[model samples]
Target: MSDMTIGKVAQAVGVGVETIRFYERRGLIEQPLRPKSGGYRVYPDETVQRVQFIRRAQHLGFSLREIAELLSLRASHGTDAIEVRQRATAKLQDVDHKIERLRHIRRGLMALLDRCPGQGPLRCCSIIDALEHDQRLASEPAERKEPDMQTVRLTIKGMHCDGCAEIVRHVLEQQPGVKGCSVSHENGEAKVAVDTSQTSGERLAEAVQGAGYSASLVTEAG
Candidate 1:
């Protein structure tokens, strides 16, 4: 075939051929021509332009769903600069929210660090005591339980907003034997119910902390 194919287009755009198919499936790119002479795939210069636009939007942090919407809008009448600005502004708000929450965690952790010099028994350590106390407090006020469910509460710190809760939930779900996890930013709690025989509270707590959130297991099993 004289004209380039999907493989060639993908190589030119630094993307996998499967990505090109995905873009087509997502309606971000139209199907290329099948030339009569060889019935081979053929890509025009415009296909390259569309591919670059997709890459650029992805680099700008647009989700695939969002990019598809933008591409649809463009195909009809093109997107307004105002709409682009609005999407960007919304993303900024999300980033700002995360930053503000992290700042709160940093302040609390720094204060705890300052109070405790990090050299003492686990019981004598102020930070550990504080963590335990906070964990204990978070365990309360969720007494109601659904049928067929066992409740376990974790005391987690460094959660600034609901997004942190999502992060906690996502991290916990990855662990083996973990059934499900629900994190609450308002209560500073991560409520998880898992197979006791497979997963331990200490291991789950460590996983939560590893996801950039501070957490500890409370002694109260109820």
Candidate 2:
């Protein structure tokens, strides 16, 4: 087998040099020892195949931990095809759940879009009106306000598009005591201003979860 430089190996495998280093760090692939007069570490052709295996496993929704297990199975003399198939089956179920959730989200957005006129004053647009109303309601003062409002940011996963962000913002803003809310699918986060006495970071997370997204508090404002 021909020896290859790190860059050459990465190029051959359609991965970056940093990815190769990361794989080495993750113990997914063994790094060859540097020669005494070496300017860079060299790898055997087998390393390219190993990196490709990692990439394919990732595309199949396997986490690095699971991929490591798969690699272990491959290295063992008594590898079980049934065990690998079981993992893949579980991954398929996860993907199915995600697809179902996405379909529900799509239906909701489509309903909203259907109600929209598609051409009108921004203020009169159905989608814009709904969003604006949510914002206005959220910003309205509570029956008793002592300025205990605080800001909180939460990282939300599964927001696949801008419409998902809008849905998340709308849902969060509807929560009692929310003063304002903003969500960004691109950033995968939601920022909310709420009356801590009437609501809380935990409640905000619950609202986000109800909206069909996984959420964790990123920052809590005092």
Candidate 3:
């Protein structure tokens, strides 16, 4: 078939006319020039297929930039399947990491819920207290003695503001053996001092992750 009007192309591709225009603006698709008669901008039939391809890629979690690269690879000569596979593999790994993070978040939330007594004074509510104080509901006994003091550095992600840093600092300080912690949102890192007998770097990392962020132990000091 010959070229189609923008409306017809949108109908064929099951997308809105503005969506096509947006794709054009994003350089995902070309915008045909108006004819000398100046009636309407028409799109080639191939645009329908390309739009479909873009939508399919989006459903597979490919960003517009990645889709553009995929389109370029498709149009380029001597492109290897391995190149496409590598991108897919990277995306898969990203999805897996997100899934694991979500699971960790779920566990943290469930633990909080389990500790909360449904009926209690607002100030005494475990959930409310946890949020207000940045501490877990159930913590280690206060009688535990500190023998070995250690300091650990952690690389944190997803902190966007000063409030997030403050929350992270409080969470660390509230941990069983944690004596103190310094969190910097600008640096995306935290240095924590703890009693090694009660908490390790790994445990500190888990505490940070449980507070709705990603954290990894960078270094440990005795």
Q: Backbone clashes per model, in order?
A: 0, 0, 0
Instruction: List the RMSD of every prediction in angstroms.
Output: 20.8, 19.2, 18.7
Off by over 4 Å in 3: 136-222
lDDT of 1 by residue, 1-222 (tens): 234788888888899999999999987888866767876688876888888999998887788888887777677764444455445555555566667666667777777777796776777888888887773222222232223223457898899888888899899878765556667799898767554566688898988878888888877743
Error of 3 at 208 (Å): 45
Specify the highest-TM-score model's number.
Answer: 3
Please give the range of 10 consecutive residues that has the lowest summed lDDT in model 3: 137-146
TM-score of each: 0.46, 0.56, 0.59
Candidate 3 residue-wise lDDT, 90-183, digit = tens: 5665677667666667776888899889995887788877788777534332342325655678999999999999999998988986656678
Q: How accurate is candidate 3 locally (lDDT)?
A: 0.82
TM-score attained by model 1: 0.46
Report RMSD for candidate 2: 19.2
Candidate 2 residue-wise lDDT, 1-222, digit = tens: 588999999889888899999999999999988889968888888898999999999998889999999999889987545456545655665677777666666766776788888886887788877676663222222232244556677889999999999899889889887766778799898777666888888888998898789998875342
* Candidates sorted on TM-score, descending: 3, 2, 1
Displacement of residue 216 (Cα, Å) in model 2 is 45
User: What Cα-based lDDT does every candidate model obtain?
Assistant: 0.74, 0.79, 0.82
